[model samples]
Target: MLGARGGWQALRGCASLPRAQPAVRLRVREALGAREPAGEVKVQGWVRSVRSQKEVLFLHINDGSSLENLQVVADPSLENRDLTFGSAVEVQGKLVKSPHKMQNMELKAETIRVVGPCDTWSFPLKMKERHPLEYVRQFPHLRCRNNMLGSLLRIRSEATAAIHSFFQDNGYVHIHTPIITSNDCEGAGELFQIEVSWVEKLPETHFFNVPAFLTVSGQLHLEVMAGAFTHVFTFGPTFRAENSQSRRHLAEFYMVEAELSFTESLQDVMQVMEDLFKTATNTVLSKCPRDVELFHKYIAPAQKDRLEQVLKNKFVTISYNEAVEILKQASQTFTFKPEWGCDLQTEHEKYLVKHCGEVPVFVINYPYDLKPFYMRDNEDGPQHTVAAVDLLVPGIGELCGGSLREERLPFLKSRLQRLGLADAYEWYLDLRKFGSVPHGGFGMGFERYLQYILGVDNIKDVIPFPRFPHSCIL
Candidate 1:
């Protein structure tokens, strides 16, 4: 029987057979990392590559958990067909440095243990065949095994954790907001309506007395919490049925929202956004170095250096009027010319940000007609009531959307009445009626932010399970 150390010794001594070696142990990753021949290593992982050389079988194995894979040279006399591609196995081998970089390390196996067998017909992942995103999305279970999807998912996880940590360290209370809400916070009228079926003797309503729609944002709810907590935030999945197939929009996506009470000005909101973006990007860069490297190398080659540029450069802030002016000046490419009152289209947003280089730029003070009714009116400005700021990135525009809310009950009520939303927001007005403060918050599109940070094109690539305008793939 091979001891664990002896098993590793067998793998290391594979290039030249170790004399009279007992049992050995090796993991697929450790065999891949085997640079020294003095010590023994044991590794276990899925089969990544296989080649038959007469009597010996040279196999490359990877454990989906990491980017590294181990090289195993097994004698065909052991009848190791059970360790085929996608199969899990344990190998005891001696670690030896490889002459070539492709197979940087080598393992000579004494005993190979089969852990589990992958279905030949069902296992779609293989070294020879790499599937596209559309086909991979069809197989959700195996999608993570692919290099691009795996790195993107890993970055998503890291970014999520970083977002939470950034909020926690910055004296913000993490609020878990409700998913079902009666209010349409954005007031865009693109809601996915919720209804229930009742076949037996019906009530007059089709919704089974539950007049609820999926929450488009947690901003209002976080405001309630911010009243008590001073600084509060919510990270949750929000639903939007806008039917927009844009590269930045998703029907169901995560949002990072933070509402701060007693902010001095819009500058405070910009500060929070800049700090949060930096923290998220730096955290992912540090924690998921390998993933970041892969993204920098393959998916987004330009973004690797751009990440640092965004971090080091000071973020620029401009008014909606100024952005419109710049857009109009650069209107050669835009189909819809930028007007004073018109909303900044995604194309215009991207063009302006590209002008600002890789740094994030805040487009503030949008026109009253272009924004929601909740934003505070600029007292010193002309007719622009929207006290909003949208954080624009280089490749992806509008990563974060936020505003200083109208805190005064009278102004809010008057705006609601003018917009014909008083009836819809009766409860929202109540917050202002009871006890209101100078509260402001912003909503960051989680996938949009991820796409910007990761340099990905389609928003679908950033989300693990994406729900688009017409897609609800399992």
Candidate 2:
């Protein structure tokens, strides 16, 4: 059963797709990049514009491959009622050099076919009109047709690839953590408990036989993997059950988490975090310059030079004590007054970034009581703190959060026992019972990272499907 007789033979029927001959199908990107004339080629895309003149007709089409649309020139006789904005079409054309100064190539079509026509009267988007982001947000299913969201999605895709490459290049094993877990990593209890819809008749029964909830963070799971593989990471969707009315919180979001083994100091963790951010930013800028330019040119003009300066220099670092002192001494009054032991609020974080010269800053050494139990405890006189750090950027308050995890069995056991999570996390304690080393890791909010790089105001705009308090549209 395990050999090729049953294993490979059973899947042989569905192993590979059917091989076929090639056709003259060309993507808009390829068509636009043609140097000389491409004869008898076919291009298919949705119509972005259809203009009719007395002598000729002009058509602009895009196939989601790039931001730039390919120009199609044809005789006025090819124009039809179905050839409107947002309609899908196929053109048998010859690609040639364009006379226009803006673009390089244009498509000279012999025949045009309307594969899918758009009902322009009922369509929400208009031809050549730049709709506001909020107006297009109402139509989530169709908003990708808009230029801004398309650019955003393209940049997001590149950033994701760059992050994965950064970890792989550094010899880190990528792990797929579970979506449903019993342990709440943050211990804040903001969890979405799972239940069977059909089991509503039996109110007392449990679905998984225990209280299972969507995982908040993969940090706890990555800690387990770190013991085996020295460096490990996971990037996936994480869920939270909050009536999130703010722009920052989403019911479902993504987190990029990494764990390291035998790391003695908190700086080791901070260095990796910094490197990941800079590498991803550089890759995205290099790969998708025009898509990135769309936002920098229109959305946030001042962000361009600030980002250049940020990439040129090192990020600033300060302790929680210093940050609190800085906030207290600032001329601007905070809504929540700055205190030594309390957690830093958004206003406090923004002020601290401003105080640090508008560059990204790492605020470390948080109060032990204010942090989770898993952080390594630093024993000091009357004022104990943990080795935790938060990377704050110019626009976004907190982009990344990390800490040196408690590797000692006795320290972790005592802390978990005090918090009444010892019984539930016995598997986690067992990792320390064996061969445990001083380990640390960090988690970066994917949307927050995108928001920081692009200077996006709302967190909802960066992500494709904005899942928040009263919205879950297709």
Please tell me which predicted candidate would have the highest lDDT against the true structure. 2
Please write out the lDDT profile of model 1 over residues 28-61, one tens digit for every residue.
5445555567355567777776788788878777
Number of the predicted model whose TM-score against the real structure is largest:
2
| Model 2 agreement with the true structure over 1-474: per-residue lDDT tens digits | 468777766666664756443438999988887788876789999999989999989999999889999999999999998999999999987888899999899999889999999999999999999988888889899999999999999998999999999999999999999999888999888998988788345777677778889999999999988889999999999988888677677888999999999898999999999999999999999999999998899889888899999999999999999999999899998899999999999999999999999999999999999999899998875789999999999978999999999998999999989988899889989999989989999999999899888988888888999888778997
Give the Å shift of residue 389 in candidate 2: 0.4
Clashing pairs in model 2, backbone N/Cα/C closer than 3 A: none
Angstrom error of the Cα, residue 120, model 2: value is 0.8
RMSD of each: 6.9, 7.3
How much does candidate 1 score in TM-score?
0.85
Model 2: CA > 4 A from native: 1-23, 199-201
